[model samples]
Each structure stands twice: as C-alpha cells, then as structure tokens.
Target: MLIIEGLTRRYGDRIAVDDVCLEVPRGSFVGVIGRSGAGKSTLLRMVNRLADPSAGRILWEGRDVTALQGRALRDWRARCAMVFQQFNLSGRLDVLTNVLVGRLNAVPAHRSLLRLWSAEDRAIALSALERFDIGELAAQRAEHLSGGQQQRVAIARALVQEPDIILADEPIASLDPRNTRVVMDALARINREFGITVLCNLHALDIARAYCDRLVGLSAGRLVFDGPPEALDAAAARELYGLEADEAVDHAPALPGPTPQVAPFALHA
Candidate 1:
C-alpha cells in the first residue's frame, strides 16, 4: 500500500497542495481529478519525488519516500516510473533506443553512455514495444510516429522499467478524442493485465469514471472526495469543480484557458 500523510506543497504563502492524505492499494487504477490549479499534478509529482513536499510524508510499504536521497532516491524513482504529458521521449533516437532508456538505472553508466545494450536488454525493450503493438516501428525515429503511437511508445518505455507504480501526469491533455481513448485504454490494459498500480491525473470526468477503479477529487489543493466512480454524483462534482450540476456532466471537459500559476518547481511535469 502507498500512504500519503498530510502532504503539502507551498509557494511562499500559497499552498498548492494542502494537507492531503490518502491510501492507494496495490494493483488498483486511481484517477486524480480537478480543475487546472487544483493541485492534481502537484500531488503526483510529489509521489514520484520530482518535486519535494513542503511538509508531511509519503510512505510506500514502510519507507518514507519524502526522505530518500542519492542512490536510494534514484532506486525509488526506478520503481515508481512516470509518464508525462509531453511523452518525454528522445525524438531523434530510434524507437528501440528510446525504450531502452528505461534501463539506465540498471545498466552501467559507461555502457549506457556508449549506447551499448545487451541482447537481453534489447529483447526486453522489443517485447515492450510488441506489447503495445508497435514492435514494427522499433527501427523508426520516435519523432516520426503519430501522436497515438508516440504515446504508446512512451507507455512501452515505462513498462521496460518494470515499475511497481506508474504516475501518469495529464497524459491525454494534448491528444485528440480518438488518441485520448487509445492512450487511456493502454493505461487500463497495463493496470489490469500487469497489475501495476496506476495513478493518473486526468481532466475528463468521463474518462476517469470509465477507466479508474477509484476517484480522488481535489479542489484548491484540498482532497474533497475519495470513493468509487459511481459515488461521484452531481453534487460531489459541483463541490470539486465549483460548477452547477448541469455543467458537471461526465462528458464535460475541464475548464479551458490558462492554468493558474503554480510554483516553478511544480510546472515541469
């Protein structure tokens, strides 16, 4: 189980994530939903240790993730891989090489710097690509793939990490409706077939409801609701998004426009 206790992040006086607490069970698919500045992304970044919390603790199993540093922190990150909104792949690199980057922590620095991957490592990376139905694209440049395919390559790369948890931060925000469904379905498959814990930050309530086993609603950085998707009624939606019941329909897109300004550390993904 992953336990978050009184987790908080602040930018001088403003609290981006305030006193949030929750427990995530193993092999569960969780969706973290909110408006642009509601701290959904901040919370996930903290979990992955990409951003440090101003206060509180994140406990995975029995260890405090907030306190890890150096090699320990690197190992922790390897176990908890992140999938970003931008699909963070080396566009110039071939698909196979991009996927193989996930093994950086396990491979020796010298070998990785020289791009010398072992046959087993190459096979593993190829298998991950095949799992996502993109093995044929392994020889192509990552930049040449379509948005849906690039996102799938990103997922394949995450799978190569053999992570216990995958933190997807607004992964579908930039994709079209069709690609959105494809990416979301891939995440669902990973969670269900591989039993990897998934914590996805999403803007669409309909997608969250359809894909996540549990929903966590954040409003102005405070966790307002935690329950099964069926329990996120109109009233709960209103409380979470500050919207009228009619505007809180499952298909309603997140409020469009510039996201509210957050701390610089929290903006990178």
Candidate 2:
C-alpha cells in the first residue's frame, strides 16, 4: 500500500498541492482528474520523487519515501518508473537501446556509459517490446516511429524497470482519440497482467471512468472527491471542474460501464 499523508507543494506564494491525504491500495488503478492547472502533474511528480514535496510523508510498505537519499533514492526511483506525455526517449537511439536504459540503475556505471549491455538485459528489453506488440521496431530509431508507437515504446521502457508502480503524467494528452484508446488499453493490460500499480493523470473524464478502478478528483490543489466512477454524481462533477450543471453535463461524456457499488469518499482538507 502507498500512503500519502498531508502531501503539499508550494511555489513562492502559490500552493500547487495543499495538505492532501490519500491512500492507494496495492495493485489498484487510480486516475487523477482535474483541470489543466489543478496540480495533477505536481502530485504524480512528487510521488515518483521527481519533484520535492514541501510538507508530506510518502510511505510505501512502511518505509518513508520522502526521506530516502543517494543510492536509496535511486533504488526508490527504479521501483517507481515514470512515463511522460512527451515520450521521453532518446530520438537518436534505437528502440532497443532506449529500452535498455531502464536497466542502468542495476548495472555498473562503466557498463552503462560504455553501452555494454548484458545478454540477459537485451532479452528482457526485447521481451518487453514484444509484450507491447512492437518487437519489430526494435532496431528503428525512436524518432521515426509514429506517436502511438512511440508511446508504446515508452511503456516498454518503463516495463523493463520491473517497477512496483507506474507514475504516468498526462501520458496520452498528446495523442489523437484513436491512439488515446490504444494507449489506455495498453496501460490496462499491464495492470491486469503484471499486477503493477498504476497512477495516471488524465484530462478526459470518460476515459478515466472507463479505465480506472477509482477516480481521484482535485480542484485547485485540494482533494475534492474520491470514489468509484458511478459515485461521481452531477454535483461532484460540478465541484471538480468549477462548472455549472449545464456545463458539467456537456463535459462528462456518456460511456457505458457498470456502476460500481463502492461509495464516494469525503472531501479532504
């Protein structure tokens, strides 16, 4: 389980995330949803330790993730891989080499710097690509693949890390609707097959409801709502987006799914 206690982040006078507390059960898929500047990205970044939290305690299996440093911090990062919206791959490098970078923390510094990857690591990288149905592109440079393919490659790289959880920060924001479904399906498959925890920041409400086991709604840095998709009613929707009833209706797309029986959670401070 992952526990986020009083998690907060500030920039000058502005608070990016405010005294938010959330508990994520192991192997669950949680989608963080809000407007563009609602601090969704900052929240995920702090969870991955890519950004510092002003005041908070991130505990994973009783260990304090917030206090880890040096080799310990590097190990924590390796255990919690990040996938970005921009597909952070080396454009000049071949797909296989980019995927092999995930093993850098496990290998000696000299081996990584010299690109002397082990045969075992090469097999692992190739297997990850094959899992995502892109093994044929292993020799192609990352720059040449289409956007959807590139995102899949990014997913493959994250998979090779053997992470306990994936922090996907607006991972599908740059893709078209068709590609969005493809990428979301890939994430779902990973969570289902590998039992890896997934915390994703998403903009589209329908997509969140369709894929996530639970939805976490943030409004201007505050925890506004937490619940199963069915429990997110019209009032909660309005609060999340700061919208009137009419606008809220328009914003929530009609998607078909069974209404989960779980109840909605109370708002946080």
Indicate which candidate wins on lDDT.
Answer: 1
Candidate 1, 1-269: lDDT as tens digits: 99999999999999999999999999999999888899999999999999999999999998999999999999999889999999999999999999999989889999999999999888888877877678899999999998888989998888888888999999998888778877887788778767889999987788888888899999999999999999998788888877633443446333223323321111011
The sequence of per-residue lDDT tens digits that candidate 2 reaches over residues 1-269 is 99999999999999999999999988999999888789999999999899999998999999999999999999999889999999999999999999999889989999999999999888888877877678899999999999999999998888888888999999988888767777887788778767889999987777788889899999889999999988888778878886533332323333433332322211111
lDDT against the true structure, per candidate, is 0.87, 0.85
**Model 2 bad stretches (over 4 Å):** 244-269
Which residue pairs does candidate 1 place in steric collision? none
Mark the regions of model 1 whose C-alpha exceeds 4 Å error after superposition.
244-269
Task: Rate residue 48 of model 1 by lDDT.
Answer: 93
lDDT for model 1, on a 0 to 1 scale?
A: 0.87
- Per-residue lDDT of 106 in model 1: 84
Sliding window of 10 residues with minimal summed lDDT for model 1: 260-269
